[model samples]
Target: MRTTRRWWVPAVAVAVIAAVLPVTPATAQPVSAGPGPVVADGVTQPVFGYADAIRERIFVTSDVDTDADGALDVVAMDIIRPRASEQGLRVPVVMDASPYFSTVCRGNDSECKADLDGDGLNDRWPLFYDNYFVPRGYAVILLDMIGTNNSTGCPVTGGRADNISAPTGIDWLNGRRKGVDAEGNEVVADWHNGRTGMIGKSYDGTLANAAAATGVDGLTTIVPISAISNWYDYSRSNGLVTRANNYSGSLANNVTNPDRRQYCAPVRTQLGQGGDDATGDYNDFWAERDYLPHAGQVKASVFVVHGINDDNVRADHFSKWWYALAEQNVTRKLWLTGTGHIDPFDFRRAEWVRTLHRWFDFWLHGIDNGIMREPAVDVERLPDVWETHADWPLPGSRPTQVFLRPGTDGGPGGLSVRSGPGNRSATFRDTPTMSQATAIRHPSDSSANTENRLVFLSAPLTAPLHISGTPIVRIKASVDGTDTSFAGLLVDYGTRERFSTSGDGIQTRSTEDCWGEAATFGGYAEEGCYRQTVKTVASNPQELVTKGVVDGLNLDSLFVSTPLVPGAKYGVDVPLMPEDYVFETGHQIGVVLLGSYSGYSSRAKQTRSQITVHFDSTRITLPVVGGRQAAVAAGLG
Candidate 1:
């Protein structure tokens, strides 16, 4: 059913022919063109010869004029391909289109650079794609997204202009759009086979997700690492604003060219208005940036990777996107890690490269590598421990409801199915300044700000408890104010030092491991390696498993808010961050209920409100697999 191409043989011969071919001053000689020795991986010794790879620049036109200019904006692409491409050897393309190219430094050293000439080309490209992929018979294109680097436009953040920029480049590569060189000479991607794969991290990866959602031709696959599927989800969660006022405009200003600020002032003002920090409701602006609505249009297969504990992009972005893609029956695979905001290349280097190699080879080069036949999900259970499953959420996980009730002698509280009187309640004041650590620590001690939160704890587990999916917390409560914030945290209370993967998990730079065909290249050398990392360990007696927040006013809907009637009870469901974690025996599962989370919401000191939770009506449901059996065997169910 599948066909494989032996592109390697011809790929090697093209390198040899490059030696006799004439080259211009702008391009380097084909290293493979000269007679060397073939390496172990077949083809030529060093594959495409990284040292003699051809480097050039081109501009691809975008669909929007972000700066209000009459002409459409254009994105700048810096290309590094095997010299054999110039000798009539067609190769597939791997691209990373990012606005952070000139601003954020990538890799362990944090080395970032700007354009050498004013011609929209960088002297030093970030990351190791040029050094690694180019030598493997692929053309690596480092793109400067429109409005950043040497591109002609204003950065619109995740607006319409930003969403379509990268896809425009793919269109140009496939002959649907036009491109030009630095000298304004019309350029065409004749040397490429028109097959492309996009890969990147954070904003770079976000661009890939957006571009793939457009269903652009020639895009065979996309690898989005910790990428955002919806800009609205990035800035807000269930009606709760995560950043200060005008978050979008501030971000736009950070990426836009300083010289074009005056021209893009109106656009920035529009961004600020659309964001509407005063009322964190979903608007048309957010709708335009949401890729989930367009996920059905995606024609390319997807390989997604994300950190389960990453609060930066957060797991919600990936979880929701993955669900949508699944509904569309899209071919997909996932790697769910425990690190925060990190690339797999840094945490799981060897395996990441090997897996990526096969992924790209199968999709771009039509290699029958059987990558598509492997398990669809690879999840990290603990530090450096991984398991593969046929699908996510494990297969047979069931929602187990853990009810909440008052504790004896007026202690913190108790979590079980036993119901109590309906009128019994737990009261706490809205404290917006309390940290998550303080909220979970000494929860039974009423002396330490007990008035700010309500802590509910389950009995110590007799056996291991495994939670595999999103946990939902339902509460029946009434607030004293028209609007208030509600935060629910699922905590693991134990003394052992488990892998601290929440937030930016502890990472230390240590030894490096290199890959690829060779190490030396002229005066420039390429070592496709990064520092080894270890998860930060903590003995603090507790770990925040997952948390969720919501604005009381937006409980009914995210697009609109209805002020709550004071003292009138209302039921609200809060979905905690998805997780794949196991709680060992002797550990207690604790639920911390609070009014505010300063780290994830705007800081506004308002009149504190007294919130009351009906004891018998509140419950936390967890996706438990064989939990009842374990709990029963442990004598705790």
Candidate 2:
């Protein structure tokens, strides 16, 4: 579902066409054929161009009389124009079909192709032709939707049903006739009057946010990385279904098996199971293909790139699309990573392709540059830090509640920090404490049994406490076992000495569901009983509004990176992962807890074990900002 492949190929290999495209010359800005009224069906077969190589060509079309059916029927694209010195820009088109396994298959040892600037590195779109589509300038229009290299049709499986292939590639790039510019020139503004934007990651970024929620025409913006808004939560979490990884085996091999005429029949009826009403609760057909009630009909402007140890699209599905695009105010740009399922081949894919080339060069080439004046959120921290935030629970932050006493030396540096709701904690079936290192069980154990993890500190900063935002932990927990899952950590321990490393290498953080959820008698939602909810944020200032010129290379002093030498005492070690989650002394900061589900493990095991526990009365709210106007947004007043 979102992998680079590690093993498992029961079936899924049939996508070839290879080469036959060459005609390129429709390039934007042309579509005024006035003096009459022909709104809809007017494009029977105009556009052409398919060099496929020699500086790329793409821009194709179809219809040997679509319904007249003389038999031609096809379409193709791969545009990307603009930047010819930029003036009144208007340009912002990006389609990208992605899905080329190379003739029934052959590539992966590391290169299955399609590398659109993710920079694990691979290019061929406009040159060698592996074509993941990236001419970069900002006006791309690819569409091999299913026919492959030559471009025809038949391979569907996208969302919003009806044989979805991203709404037939967004209805042929905004209903035809005008989009070509890889040197064949053409762009005064046509691809539906310019201003379009959509980038993909997994299944073309899950149909570029359901084709911008069908608001249609000139989309305006969408990012969708490591996607899935809901296909039973993209293969169950609380309901269960996980079938052994690789995102449910690429939804079962490159999308269900449609061989036959070599690929088509709506490609296995647009990717298996769309019938008998596939239910799992959250209704309305998953509310019209769940991208969060169409995040307010998306009309563009949305960026959500994820990978918080993505065990296949589970960073809580990017915090459920960032709280449904912040409850429909929309305006979002978030890129969080800890690697584990694409989108972070280190250097966070060149800081996420420069925040996708300056957010499509300022909303599809409007280019005042300021990139919407940056700072909406940008977090990449672990054993290292880079922080930015203006929004995202940063407005007057104050959740403050901390407690977890119960460590008569059982580990966690002799734990003890008393305050509330106590019972001398330890009840998820208490039986932990004994670690040398071990937890990956299927039927094996080498003696690394440890639990009772609880660490909390906060009292050495009369001046340097910044904590950018969102880090909760309210464990009152209890479980005779009916289904429970936990994982939470947010370490910082400032001065104890040992500087250097301030974010982006991630020291300790394991994410797949993170915190528990389905125990429903109506208890344990947020305040203890396993309530460790820190929905993605190591340092987020709304990605510096919108990527603040590549997040201005953060690390803005903190005694120039932890130099408190004065009475010294800054600490924040949440450590929970002990079923074999090692990174060792990268200055300690780990969080790896599994058994996923809620209230206490019922059947959430992605293999990796280290049982034994008894930690009661654990509470951690921590939204805290503290005085001097909270270090005045880190400028230190």
Candidate 3:
């Protein structure tokens, strides 16, 4: 039920395959035994030259006139392929179509696309994709998103204009769309085999999601790292606007800065209205930007990489998308880490590049590398330690409900497998002035300042308890006023060292390592080398596993608003953020309920509204790794 629309067509018009891949001669290292690029082991070799790769600039037309210029928009594309493609070698494409190429830089190093000669062709490419992949017989295209950097139109975050930018270029590569050069001369991807794989981080990755969702033919695979699939989930959650006013417009403006977005002033204003910050409801405006409902349209295989601790894009985006993809029987893979909004190339460097190379070879070049035969998921649960699984949520993972009980002698309540006494209930006054941390932590303080929240804890775990998926907290509560919000935090109460979401959770090492090939422009050597990073860790008494907050009016549905009556209980189902965390032995599970969570929302107008909870009717259903027996064995009962 995650998706209601069927947007994917069963059959797409794919390009005809005519050419057969050539094999390289064996040398000191292992070479190709069959078709496709030369492989030493499972990965393709850097046989094609990069320093003299065929680099050119072109434009592809797209639908919509975002700038109100009365003409269809054109996206600026910069292509880099192996010079061997100029001969008779037909190579696959790897594209990083990005909106950040102009206004903002990407990754920890803050790198951006550079055009030294101002001729639309890039003098320097961001990241190491070009240096690494071009030599491996793949073409890496750096696309300037519509309305930014030599492209025409306005950038409206996840709207149609922004989503189709990459797909149109894919169409051009497949000879289905018109493309022109710097002098307006027609240009066709004559050397391309019509197999394309999109990869990027953040907004760039977001475009990859958009492209795959369009069911665009010839797009064989996508590696979306820390990307957003639903814009509504990005800015709003269950009728609560999580971001500032006009977030879509502000984000659009930021990505197209330095006067490129000048003529798109009116378009920006319209985008602000489309967000509907005041009501925070799902409407047609949000529908155009949401890719979740259209998840069935995905035809390409997905290799999803996301930070489990990424609050910017949130983990729910990937989890929900994965669920939808699973329902559609889409081939997929997952990589979950303990870092923030960062690319795996920076953290997991060696493995990521190697795995990614094999992935592209298998999908784009049809190399039959047996990547799909491997485990479907790689999870980094304990800091640097990693484990592989058949799929996410684990095979034995199932829903386990835990009841929230009241304190016996006016202390903290308990979490039990059996339902608590129906007669008892807890109440907390709305406190917008208090921080979310103060509301959830320090339950033993006995201070009146913390009375604005209710805390529930379970007995210390005797065994490791794994919470592998999304946790739903269904509460029957009554608020004194209609303008109140509620929040719940799933906590791991134990003193230990863990990865913190603060910063990038890394320290820059002195040694620098290079990826792919080096380049020089105007005697300046761009060695493609980068300083390595080590994951940072922090020790704390407790770690916040996941959180969920909701506006009191959105008890039933996100699109519908129902006002809460005074002293009338209503069922409020709050789904916490998706998480893959393990509570070790001796650690306790904690849940905190607060009014007006100040850390996420600012709509707690008066902060005087008090909430009354019904203990018997409220329960948290967690997707536990081993189901009910696992909870009881961990001492929850």
Best by lDDT: 3
Checking candidate 3 for backbone clashes, the offending pairs are 8-297
Candidate 3 lDDT by residue in tens digits, 373-452: 67778999777789998878777888999998887554778898899789777787877788866766786554532368
Show where candidate 1 strays beyond 4 Å.
1-46, 113-122, 258-263, 417-423, 448-450, 501-503, 517-532, 602-605, 627-636
- lDDT tens readout by residue for model 2, 1-637: 1111211111221011001111111344444332211112211111111222112334334422212224443444544343331333222356655544333322111222243443322233321111211222334554444444444444333433311444444444444444334444532233233455666666556767766766665566778777766554555433333333323224434532345233344334433444212222233333445666667776566777765545555556666666666676666766664443454323343354445656665555444345455676565544224466555434555544445444343333222233533445432222222121212111011121124333333333334443433444444333343222344444433223222223322333232221111211112111101111122234421111000000000112211122112222112222221110111221222122223322222223332222223344455444445523543322222
Q: What is the C-alpha RMSD of each candidate to the true structure, in Å?
A: 6.3, 21.6, 5.2
Ranked by lDDT, the better of candidates 1 and 3 is: 3
- Clashing pairs for predicted structure model 1, backbone only: 15-33, 39-45
* Clash tally for model 1: 2
Off by over 4 Å in 3: 1-36, 118-120, 448-450, 522-524, 602-606
Candidate 1 lDDT (Cα, whole model)? 0.77
The positional error of residue 419 in candidate 1, measured at the CA in angstroms, is 4.3
- lDDT for 317 in candidate 2 is 61
